[model samples]
Target chain A: MTLKVYADRMSQPSRAVIIFCKLNGIDFEEVRVDLSKRQHLTPEFREINPMKKLPAIVDGRFKLFESHAILIYLACVFPGVADHWYPADLFKRAKIHSVLDWHHSNLRRGAATYVFNSALAPALGMPLNPEVAAEGEKLLSASLAKIESVWLKGKGRFLLGSLQPSIADLSLVCEIMQLEVVDEKDRERILGPHQRVLKWIDDTKNATQPYFDEVHSILSKVKEKLKKLQAERGVSANESIGRTTLHSKM
Target chain B: MTLKVYADRMSQPSRAVIIFCKLNGIDFEEVRVDLSKRQHLTPEFREINPMKKLPAIVDGRFKLFESHAILIYLACVFPGVADHWYPADLFKRAKIHSVLDWHHSNLRRGAATYVFNSALAPALGMPLNPEVAAEGEKLLSASLAKIESVWLKGKGRFLLGSLQPSIADLSLVCEIMQLEVVDEKDRERILGPHQRVLKWIDDTKNATQPYFDEVHSILSKVKEKLKKLQAERGVSANESIGRTTLHSKM
Candidate 1:
């Protein structure tokens, strides 16, 4: 049986997993567990991951959840995958682990929370929270700075100076991709100061190619869809959310 | 030169790293960087860890941060350490990764945020935010439920059904240890429902004895100090916090 990747494109980690499978030509089925529809909360889905989160995988009888775990598992189990994605050297692998762990608490938190409050909440008809957005933006900038000054200055195009993109590069870049849902100006303002981060994203994109773009096309559509929705709903909904996404994006 | 560990025992991750080294009998120097005095923010500390976080390690020329990464690095590098801490097997290690990654965003976030907003804030002389604390409580409960229903249900004494404790065990158990700072009643109120989780913490503590209690002695003193401070400051100090940490803890 083919490896089963249960995901929804809307989730940042889910997209990362889907793109990774495609990039490596790993034989897998994309089983959509849509978060918006509450599909992941169902009992059927719970059997795969008791946590009830997306981006889970099942290889034969063995099952796994959490994107970083899934990614690492794939890297190790799949013989066809390149060594650079998750090297055999202990130190190199540990460094990647550091980046991934930090990304979870720092990058993912800041990017996702900020995007959800600033953009997606209103578009999805949920209450907008400027307070959370502000806090997330502060964290977001700090994480970007860390990426630029500390992680991405490596000799290689990837994080920790690796010549090839590791799972860390893929995980973090996908997190930044969530910013695409925000208006063009906010996206620029948030990511602008970190030139290294921007270039590294581009480099990672180039490295993975067609799959990266193909996987992220869903996000671009969601952005356009959200802007059109906010434009239709008009002022009242966007008022609670400062920096309304509609006028700026449209 | 001995491996140098820069840490403050008050920080959860820092204590985990310290305890792990002692438990394994790895030679190291404990270089304290106190968080309360903002010592971690100093330029000298930044040289050790660019993120300015606790529990960084400098092994001769190699400097590393993020406790999970440091744990993995240590397990792989140190020959004296046992295999179960971070086994050589690909599958066993990947499962451990899942727990550690989940612990970061879910367990660590909920535990630390709740402890800070609910109990630690007023004790340390910061303003209370009941709204954030309530949200943290909800996340904390959900995380504990996951721990009970999912991770700890394994056949063995540790998570993932491992007969021996892994780094995942150390990292998470240390995170749960932060709850000690909260008033005893609230700790029971929050952790009471999750029987398996409580037992697992005990099991993990047993797996890494002496060092666990030795490292946590600082937290015990802090708990006492906070109680005395709150009592001395009087009721008005605890008024804003709805739960009122004084009566139950004392």
Candidate 2:
């Protein structure tokens, strides 16, 4: 049986998983979960993931959530490609795992929150709180400082010294790419003052260019659909009048 | 060469590592990093782990941090004990890994912050902030809710359905047990209102009684020494003062 991936293109982790599948030449059916309508909370989706989170998978009898876990599972289950994505050397593998663990609590959460509060909120026509946005920016700065000092410092090409991309880069690139979806001012703040990070972002994009193209294509379709829906409701992209909200309570 | 574990007993993840070593009959020399004196921030410690976090290990020139990663490495390094703590079954192992990842982002972080803010600050003769304490409590509640609904919802005696304990149980027991060190009111808030969670905590403790006793005995000794030093400085246990300023910027 072919693998099946349930994802939303706009969600960072979901995009990472999609790109991983594309890069690894794995064939999987993509089931998009509409984040704006909170479809993930419905009973059908809840049956797949009790946590009601995105980036879940079902391969025959096996089911899993947590994007990193899913990525690791893919690497392990598809052993032929493991050398490229998850290296075999004990310390090298551990470093990748360590960086991935760090990313969850640090970069992924901080960047996603900043984008959500500053960009997605305004895009969805919700009121953006300046206080929360400011806090998000502060957190983004602190998170990026650690990423620069600890993970990316002295690493060549890809994270963990991989000549090609690893799951570490996939995990990070997805979240950082969401910066573009944030307000232009916040994007400038993240990409402008942080020269090292900007260079890293460009390098990441170049490294995963093929997977990036596939993801961008999917996202463009999503964008067009969302645009048509908004126009039908007489809402402009910049106007704060739509009912879509990015965050799910559960 | 014997394994060397750098840890402090007061920290939850550190205690978990200590208990795992004792239970597995693995001999390791313990090197305590004094969080009170900020020993983890020293250059010497930074060489071992740039993150400057506890629960790091050195096994024959192989250095590893992150408690879950260390546990996996120890299990892998010591072959006979793998099935007991880290299971071999694919889905079962994935479940354990899933919880470990979730713990880092959720319960572990919140509970550690609570212990530091509520117990450690005042014990060290520093003022405590009610607002920070309140925020910590809120985060702790959200963590507990996730644990109850997601991880422990339909499990057996232990987290992974073991008649004997697993490392999943070991990791979780240490985290939940930190509630003991929290202030009396906060303790009541965690235990009294959350009956199901309270029962899970009791079950985990009972299952890991011997391991828990061994680690807690050493931890109690450390707590006694800290209390004596506080008393010598004439700091009242009941004094509610202003928020204590951290010497280093986070």
Candidate 3:
């Protein structure tokens, strides 16, 4: 039986899972669970994942959730895929696992909250909570700094210096990519200091190819909409009024 | 060179790693970093883990942080260890991974935050924010409910129906063990509803043996102190005054 992946591309981890399946040419069915519409919270979806999370998978009688776990499972089950993605070497795999585990409270929290406050909240017609936005920005900056100084500090193009990208690379880079949907100035402010991290993001994008772009199309559209709103407002991208106008539009 | 694990008994994940090492009989050195004294923040220790989190390890030249990652690395590197702790079976391992990953945001968050606000913050002489404490209780209760209804609903003594406890069981059980440090009334309210979760905790403790008790000795002391305080106050264990008296002692 073919693997079934339940995902919503808007979520960073979901995108990572979808991109992984697509990149490896794994035979799978992509089932979209729309988060914006709150589809994941429904009883039916809850049955698949009682946690009611996305990026879950079902292969015959077996079912799994948590994107990193799903990725590891795929890596182990699909022998056709290269080992570099989730290396078999004990030390190397452990290092990758370290990055994956750390990503949750650090990068994922920072990036996710930042994008939600700076971009998503406003777009969804909710007033931005200044305290949350400020906190989010602080977290985002710290996460970016860590990525620059720590994870991406190594000589390799990817995290952990692997020639090929691992699941950690996909998971983290997708998280950072959400910054694109934020206002240009906010994005630059949060992501600007990390030159190496920026390079790593580009490298990951290039390596993942067309599927990367495909999975990220919604974010690109969001970015474009924000840009057009700014243009219509006749205000600079960094100006507070531009954001206000965008908020009004929503 | 022997593996060097930097940990603190007070921290849940640190206890998880220490217990895993002791339980598996891995020859390693335990380097305690006293978190209450802010020892982990020292520049020297930060060299070992730039993230500055406890439960880091230095295995010769390869350094790793994050307890779950360390456990996986240990399971893989130590060939003689029993496989059920981190099974080689594809589906079984993935389910374990699923539990490990789900733990951080759910069980770990709820239990850690609940203990921090209700017990640690006050013990550290910090004022308790009632709002945060209430929120923590809600989260803790919800997390426990999920554990009983979802993770522990299976027939086996451990998660995933394994006859033997996996690292997920240790990681989660250690997290829940934090509740013991909380006030008696609050602890019962939060933990009382979930019989299965309670059973699983006992099962996990029994399975791991002396190491589980050794790692959790500090918590035991805290619990004993609270019980004594309750007795001295001439208040029932469920009474609010008992906690206030305990707070004064701390």
Whose TM-score is greatest here? Answer: 1
lDDT of each: 0.89, 0.75, 0.85
Name the lDDT value of residue B206 in candidate 2.
78
Better of 1 and 3 by DockQ: 1
lDDT of 2 by residue, B128-189 (tens): 56667667777778878777766665557566455556777788778877776554576887
Angstrom error of the Cα, residue A15, model 2: value is: 0.8
Q: How well is each residue in B156-224 modelled by candidate 1, as lDDT tens digits?
A: 888888788999989999999999988899999999988888999999998888899999989889999
Query: Which residue pairs clash in candidate 2?
Result: A125-A240
For model 2, report DockQ: 0.42
Compute DockQ for each candidate against the true complex: 0.76, 0.42, 0.74
For model 3, residues B81-136, the per-residue Cα lDDT tens digits are: 79988988888899988989988877787777667766677445575566777777
Q: Rank the candidates by lDDT, best first.
A: 1, 3, 2
In model 3, state the lDDT of residue B195: 85
Clashes of 2: 1
